[model samples]
Target: MTLGNRKKNAVKAATAAKVDALLVTHLPDVRYVSGFTGSNAALVLTGNRAVLFTDGRYTAQAKAEAAGTRVVIEKKPAVTAACEWIERAGIQRCGFDAAHTTVAALEAMRKAVTSKVRRSLFHPVGALVAALREVKDADEISRMRVAAALGCSLFDQMLSIIEPGMTEIAVAAELEHQARLAGAEGMSFDTIVASGERSALPHGHATTAKLPRQGFVTLDFGVILDGYCSDMTRTVHMGNALPGEHEAYDAVLEAQEAAVAVVAPGVTAGDVDEAARSVLRRAKLDRFFTHSTGHGVGLEIHEGPRLAAKQTQPLAEGMVITIEPGIYIPGRFGLRIEDMVLVTATGGEVLTPSPKAWIQL
Candidate 1:
């Protein structure tokens, strides 16, 4: 692939692994490693050269779409093309992505290549690619910031328009419509519009249930931009605020803020989760605040370095994660506040700058 620096990065990683070349077969890794978004393609990544092999179904489109990787149109099975390429290139000790290939495929590769050359399987070539993607450059971070801001604007757009008569599905649809109009490619996941008793469900998706005028209505949504992603959540009252709802909402906001405040390079993900959970425990609401504080997000909404009590990974500079805290009182109501954040040199930078105070919709 002739990508700006990705080809070079993949080549460098191959060299570091002491392999003559890397054969990428995973679809996502194929896209990430060589910018080949096609359904069928194998990327052969060498130090100074690369090749993209695909079936005849996409001969012309592969050539046009995958300009980064040199296209090789093959009418039959793809493994044959890979072996033939390896033999012609006189490559020795080539590496394949073990994560993507099956045992049968590995055997076929072994049988195809000459015994004089060695064949090895690497658990993940995508790992190297993912590690590279973890660091959000200024350009990437700015896109994410825009995504979050657009998501907030969409919330604003949908707020006044929504009334107690609408179903949760109706509210979610309008939120998505507003987000798309505000320049988001689409939501990273299904829009969550849980209200009243339904709010007790942690991942409660929008059902046909109509919203109640007083308890909690949790709105969780995210936007995508240029292959990057942003996530955010805000819970509000349907009409007038309830007495205890404000307290729970404030506690969730405080817990989320506490988690976000302590995020920095060298901090453990589990510690960040505890920072939020501790606040809920002090309020005797720890049992209600379930799920991880957050998770690393980028090309994929949920990536590595999970921010949960069960994880031990440390936060690193350039890593972007979310800080979300919630309290769910079963069959009653629930509230949550979430934001995307970047781990920086000093501490954390909250990319989603929207106000977290409970909205009276």
Candidate 2:
């Protein structure tokens, strides 16, 4: 969707919420509405007006990117300027995203407005823009597809260089360096390179620990391409697998694929999560399966529509989410299989078209 249409939709939402205006301080929301990708920005959206406030540094950029929106360059903080503008515009109430705003920031914004309108004017609102962003448009899905494809290519390259003696940190560095060379703006998050016993750590960051001669190495990573993010996890054996390791990997793979297969429009997030958890439960490894099945991935690494127990949110078409299932047994071995799936009307389409079968190096 176009930036103007996005702003229109946001304004409609604000009107429905009984808000005269919306003070968009979150950078992503600012970008979504005004198409301004600057570091500092504040956008105020009213029924018929969309004004973007930024510092002097981004005057030209704001004008160039944020078409159909009034751009104002202020010497003070953009958000403070936006609040002052909202008060001056005689808006009765302006809603702000409570999820991203802190107490200190809210206080600052309130101080920017006059005492009469400070308390009542700055209303706190939930994830209004974020909810709209959860459903990806065709353009967003196209960008995310490229990002996921890049992640798959990085994994393929890493498979060739991975060895028994390489330190986990070194392996992570190699992947990141190659990612930059391959045109990634940055890694979505810290590149995970857990080896052997470390594989059991759900978020085990890359460390100096060397890869074991004959154990599992779980690599969980994502890359930022364009403005979207891609995430996936793959675990590979170094030399020979232990007796239970093969069975454990199979269980996780089946669970992950099962969850991915169940991703379709109108499916409840909890049901998709159950599809994965059920596989592990049948194998009696549910206790080892930690963390939720997956979460929405897009402009942000972790977004809404959380796929976990009791999540009643239904999956919508054009939503992209990850289906990652793992069995992490402490001190023995841990393995995860992840895929980025796009929810479709019929069934889900796997964006990460990489090999998930057992890979032993």
Candidate 3:
């Protein structure tokens, strides 16, 4: 979508929130509205205009990137300048995202205006821009598809060289190196290379420990490309898998796929979680299956419409999420399988089409 259309939507949200203007201080929100990817920026949206305030560092960058919006280069803090502009505009109450605004930042913003206006202005509005960003546009989905495809290619390359006795950190380094060569802007998050017992830790990062001769190694990672993110996880056996290990991997894989199957437009997020949890529960592995089934992925690695138990949010078309189900047996073995699925009108489309079948090296 064009920046102009996005700003128009933000103005509608501001009006719905009963505010005269919106002082967007969150960097991501600012980028979403103004297309300004600078480090420091604040977007002010009124009924009739959208203005972006930044420092001298981004004067040229803002002019080039932030199209269809008024750009203002100021010496003061972007948020402070934005609040000052709001006060000068004769706005009685302006809204700011409470989730992204800290107490100190709020105080700084209030200080930029008169004491009387400060007390009444800057209302704490919750996730106004984020709510709008939950559903992706066609262009956004296309960008994310490219990012997901890159992640799948990286996973395939890692499989060719991964072997027993290699340190988990070594594997992570190779994966990251390949990602850069593949044109990834950066990793979506830390490159996870949990091996053997360490795999039992849901978020165990790469360490110096060597891969086990006979156990599971979970590689969970993602890449950022052109500003969007893609996430996927795969677990492979080192030398040989035990009988129980095979069964556990099968259970988790089934769970992950089951969740992805139900990702249609109109299904509640909770229902998707249950689809996965029910499989593990039936297999008697539910207790070991920790963490949510999945979460929405987009401009940020993790965003809205989380696929967890009791989340009432329904899936919408153009929403991309990860369906990851895992089982960790402490001190024994751990395995997980994850895929990025895009919610569609008829069903779900698995974006990360990497093979999830049993892989024994």
| Clash pairs (backbone) in predicted model 3 | none
Candidate 2 wrongly placed segments (more than 4 Å): none
| Residue pairs with backbone overlap in model 1 | none
TM value for model 3: 0.99
RMSD of each: 3.2, 0.8, 0.8
Encode model 1's per-residue lDDT on 75-168: one tens digit a residue: 8667768777877787765777675688887777777766665344322344556556676667767778888778878777777777787899
Estimate, for each residue in 17-87, the C-alpha lDDT of model 2 and write its tens digit: 88999999889888888889999999999999999999999989999999999999999999999999998
True-vs-predicted CA distance for residue 31, candidate 3, Å: 1.1
Clashing pairs in 2: none
Report the CA-based lDDT of candidate 1 relative to the real structure.
Answer: 0.80
Superposition error at 24 for model 3 (Å): 1.0
Give the worst 10-residue stretch by lDDT in candidate 3: 116-125
Best-matching candidate per lDDT: 2
lDDT of 3 at 69: 89
Give lDDT tens digits, candidate 3, residues 241-331.
8779999998999999899888899999999999999999999999998899889888899998888999999999888999999998898
lDDT score of model 3?
0.91
Over 4 Å off in model 3, which ranges? none
